[model samples]
Target: MARKPTSPADEVLLAAARARSSTVTATQLERWRGAGLLPRNVTRSLGRGRGSTSAPADGVVDLVVWLAQHARPGRRPHDLALHAFGEGLAVPEPTVRAAWRASVQRVVLSGERDLPAPADGEDRTDWAWDVAERAAANAASVVLPRRMRRIDERLAAAGVSWAPSELTQYDRGPAGEEPVTARDFATFAAAGVLAGAPELTGPAMAPHVRALLPVGAVSPVASWLEYPDEPGRDPAEINDGAGLSLLPIGDVREDLLRVIDEAEPHQLRAAWRAAAEMREWALEHCGAVEAELDAGELGDATLAWMMGAILGLPRLLVRQALLDRRPSISTQVSTAVMVLWIGVSLHRLRRLMPDGQYELLPALLPPFLHPLAGIPLKPVGEAAADDAVG
Candidate 1:
């Protein structure tokens, strides 16, 4: 059913929407237009000092119907934008960027927000030091999800191994060369990714990555991750050089927002793919671990995979993602950007290696995740040149 030009545009859209589902209303169209979930009709003036006439663009009625279907009380416009993006709906670019901004702010620490304004003529170094202190304290923000902890306890009882002993012996976290607990190391690593803490780029976090991988055979990605921090070496010669630091002092959120705001549609799609793959990896590993627990024995590989997927890369991605804990589409889309950030970082670290030194393994490498996210991996320089062109 289509509306004739004789009908009012809002009425046409509302009727089309209501035709699909009677719940849609004229007021709903107005509200969604205000929120950017729906676009207003286009208008053109009559030639002879007459008022303009208007009509909704083609297919807006369907979009209106889709928006209404997703609508609910308490849903934010950002949520609608993200959901629209995920579904390939015609949600506006500005709304999607706004959604990305909200997602970035979610993990920002309270200290970053509440810093006292610099006292008149006080050294800016004081503010710098304050930032460094709060950032170092970022590791304290790590929390083993309650459900994951419970699963670990269950597995520990079932003769499945918990966090590897190597984790305790590994040099890890802000405390240099000191052994840290598995959860401690993983927690710090999670924090470090966002904080640009140097400890993460060093040998410290390699063991955690090793423990997290699901591969049953020799994993190649670990070799690069465990690459030594050479003394007095050229900056390009080590992982510390190309590590995940973002400019403007590694405010990843700012860079990530820029990426989203500026990325081409295909790039965004690729990022989404990578995030989905990682999430699947986490789910499959946990499922295997749970199955083993049911059968009364956990595979060593499965245990390691479980820890890596949930604790290693998920970072701020929380909860079991089941029932009430299920993430909203908006949250899911936002978190994908976080994974894209990590994937791009992995790509950067890979560039530190001499050509052919490391193999590309989409199944194992965090860098290849870009391919999963929808980016084709080419030579680093070529990829850079292509991105510049795009």
Candidate 2:
């Protein structure tokens, strides 16, 4: 049977979907469009007083057909955007923006823009401590999440205890001098800045470079940031070598919201790719560590993984989320934004160096991060091959 010339666009899409063996319906199409997951159709007028003809826009039929085929019962519009963007499909721009924005909205920071000045006859140092205490209130608590503690228990059961080393203090952290960790310092620094205290920047720098690069490389790279020295440090020495530009100069949260909201389609797609890559690398690296532990072997892998326990991906994810269910794509996208921010900041630090010939830095990292750093990770395969040779 021939269809009418002016059939509704949704019906046309449905027909295309049916051809592809998809279970799409008019209602589903309407809902997807409302959620910004699907693009709207185009309408054109016929000549000589004829009625108008409406049809799905270019690539719409194919996308709709895909949506019909792959749609999960509880899958969200943001998830669809992430999948579509990942697959190189032309997802609607608004959908990508809104979904990414929503992803970052989950993280919350509480503080006032202006802190009350020290009262008359108040000790200035006491006032600073009071302010710092309030800022530290939100710092990541020392009590490990249940999942992380379970992993720690497993490591302990295996007689795998980390030596108290300067390179990786996370195993027995909260170093005696300051209760402020890199993260707590960050919170205080941010609040202090907003409250008109730029001096906090020197001490508040986050050691994100160490997470991205090895300690040896991190030292030189940190110097490249041109970070101002703290009181006890030499002027040439950047306090912990973390640069101040990792985040923009305004409200960090608001800046992130704007960045996601205003990002172009290609930009969003790039972040999606990074997000997917980050997840893959994390899973692969963590799985490799677990495999080694199960096989009763101890080596560099365990050392690196344990050192990164708190600063790396959430323990809830490694021990719980994967077993429970996958994270929503929107959340993955949000995480990617943060990763990129660190990466770009690292690159910016490098650009500050006088002689930038350290291209081998990625290859120099701990084995776990090698894959993500673009070093082709094949230690497992190599080990198997070595056994064969032996």
| Cα lDDT listed for each candidate | 0.56, 0.54
Q: Which stretches of candidate 1 lie over 4 Å from their true place?
A: 1-8, 42-55, 116-177, 181-248, 270-280, 296-326, 346-359, 365-390
Which window of ten consecutive residues has the lowest lDDT sum in model 2?
209-218
> What's the TM-score of every candidate structure?
0.63, 0.58
Tens-place lDDT per residue, model 2, 193-303, is: 333223333333324322222212223322323243334232223223454343344335565676566555655565566666655655665666677778889666666
Residue-by-residue lDDT tens digits, candidate 1, 90-158: 776677767766777776544556675365423434553455456555453324445555566676566
Top candidate when judged by TM-score against the true structure: 1
Q: lDDT for model 1, on a 0 to 1 scale?
A: 0.56
Cα displacement (angstroms), candidate 2, residue 88, comes to: 4.1
